[model samples]
Target: MQIEVLVDVKTTLGEGPLWDAQQERLYWIDSFDGRVFRATADGREIRCWDVPQKIGSMAIRKDGRGAVVSLARGFHFLDFQTGDVALIADPEPDKPNNRLNDGKVDRRGRFFAGSMDTMEEGPNGALYRLDPDLTVTRIDDGIIVSNGPCWSPDGRTFYFNDTWSGEIWAYDYDQDRGAVSNRRSFAKVDRSRGGAADGSTVDAEGFLWNALVYDGRLVRYAPDGRVDRIIEMPVKKVTSVMFGGPDLDILYVTSMAKPPLPRFPGDGVLRGSLFAIHGLGIKGVPEPRFGG
Candidate 1:
């Protein structure tokens, strides 16, 4: 399907985009710029918050609060209503180069997030699944840049991406036990595109829609690992995609402009911007917030 830009906010390293069904709003994060953005379906009523460290990812709560992964510390509970913040836990206290990245709640409403290396261009990342009891488990390791942790519609299959290897891996997920096993390569993309699979979300039909960061497009893959469809975007770096809006027919995309060169006029112009597109009317499960 063809992609049409909805709104462009010009974000720097824009990554995670989550749809909060209760509030009918979209929450996203600008990784490098340390900012979080919340907007409505019409692209109106936009609000942005400045975070102290790099804001890696965000998820809404059952009570309309926000939880963020601070790059330097651990998970934090954010008060969208009162602007108060509190730390939850730090799984990797010794690894300062690694920070939390993409994450979302599972079918059981448990938060599953991963960490990435801040210093290197290659692998040094790990995948983590946080239980409701606040126990964090290292599910997958040896990842150079961990990406999506999206689950299939049935909650039996899970998909994750290792960006540096250009492969998206699938797993047999046990929702009741909160476990993932049988790790296998789900899809491998061409390296010439300059970006691997970044953040992604699954639709009701079980198709995994992945945003190809720096490749200027979104790809839909079948459950068996076949490319089903491709949705091209205007921006070169398509950081993330999520199904949002009242009917979930709208696909909210977050993009990042190319970084500026030294002594150039493009310093902050293209780095951070929000974009949206319509036409695909797929309803995604509302992000399972903490204590859901």
Candidate 2:
């Protein structure tokens, strides 16, 4: 397999890579910068939308109007044409120290996102589900830094992780009802191995691929929680991953540039760039759009 830098944008806290198969475009977010980016599969024709607040993640709407996004304050609807942002709901209005983080849509078209404590001090955050009717529901709680939200190929299992905890959890998902239960530890990263689970995506074969930030490793996990493969990345702080390309064979990764965090230090020239992995011989399921 070969890996190439797709975009050298060097984003700060780069995360949430989303591929729109219908439009043949890729979307991503630079969390702290409050920026949303769109580019072609070849990393061409790049466009950016600057929001007023920090954006955690975004999913396209099924009606093809715009996107439903998680801003620092709460969930919002973003209009691509007029660049307008309207508040949908603030699930945690009492927690001023938390912000929404990584999220993904289920096959049934509900958006599931989790919040994180901005100070990284305690588990003052929770996971939420935004339904098609624009209503928000809390799914799980006691999270420190939320990341890596995805689902299995059959839609029966949900995968997510709390970054600082180094544990990735799996849940029994009721796809039709958008409810999750039977949470269990699917995998745990040994931080001593130089990485922590940051973001993840499931392949067509039901394997989980996770980006290990601060360690520069992409790990693929089997359905039984076995480590299937590990690919060393060129840059540390690999924040997130997604599958794109006409055939969904390319693995697109996002990384971070800033190096001030005490736990995750040291920076390199390519620290904040986007990368694409070619010839993986695997395909990804199309990301579901938000039903709302």
Candidate 3:
């Protein structure tokens, strides 16, 4: 299938593709620029919001107000109308070098996010979860760059990717207790493709769609981590993806633009933009909202 450009609002680092089923709109973040964008299914009517800080990700709220967003240091409640952020929790108050990265809410309606070092310096990052009661807890440690926190369709398996580790892991998930156990390597991407494992989503068919940032490809992996298909992209840096539209059939993607001294000359010109794919014959599940 061919991918079409949705919007050309180039971003420094685009990530976090979210689908708000209740509002029937798509939300994603320009992570480095502190911007968030909203668009309709048909790729029309785009709205941009300037967040207070480097916005890593956001989760829909159950109360219908807006999203629970992750910032450089912690979590906040972002007011939908005013673009105001009320502080919630600063997970790593002492780790100034660490910033919030990719995240998503689980089937149990709890927000799970991770933090990573800014310079990709070392394994200083860690994964965490925000309970419905507004409490914060740590999950794992020693992660340089955290990315890809997606789940399986039946809610039995939890998948997480550590870009620095170049591995996607699957764990037995406990929905009621909000826990993950028995970590196993699900997939290992060949970073030689000029990219690292980034944001991803699961399709209704029990397959994983993962973006290879700077590799210009989005790969679909079967439930067993077998490469099912690979879709080439126009730009080098494909950051993240999500399924949207009324039928949850549209696949929305985000990319990153290259800087002045373009590393791969001619590449990344169309980077940092949103792209969409349709008629893929696969559907997506609704993203759970933050129950808190």
Candidate with top TM-score is: 2
Query: Which stretches in model 3 have alpha-carbon errors above 4 Å?
Result: 259-266
Poorly placed runs, candidate 2 (over 4 Å): none
| C-alpha TM-scores of all predictions | 0.91, 0.98, 0.96
Tens-place lDDT digits, model 1, residues 1-292? 4355455667767878888888888888888787788888877788887777777787776666656454546777777666677777887898877888888888787888888876536566788877667777888887767788889988899888877677889999998988889998999875575767888998878888898876777888998889998886766677788888888777778877554222212323434566666666566665666653
Prediction-by-prediction clash tally: 12, 0, 1
Candidate 2 per-residue lDDT over residues 1-292, each given as its tens digit: 9999999888988989999999989999998899889999999999999888988999999976689999999999999888899999999999998999899999989999999999777999899999999889999999998889999999999999998887899999998898999999999786886678998999999999999988899999999998999999998789899999889999999999985367766668988899999999999989999999
Ranking by lDDT: 2, 3, 1
Candidate 1 minimal-lDDT segment of 10 residues: 259-268
**Which is the winner by TM-score between candidate 1 and candidate 3?**
3
Off by over 4 Å in 1: 1-4, 68-70, 258-271
TM-score of 2: 0.98
- Worst 10-residue lDDT window for candidate 3 reads 259-268
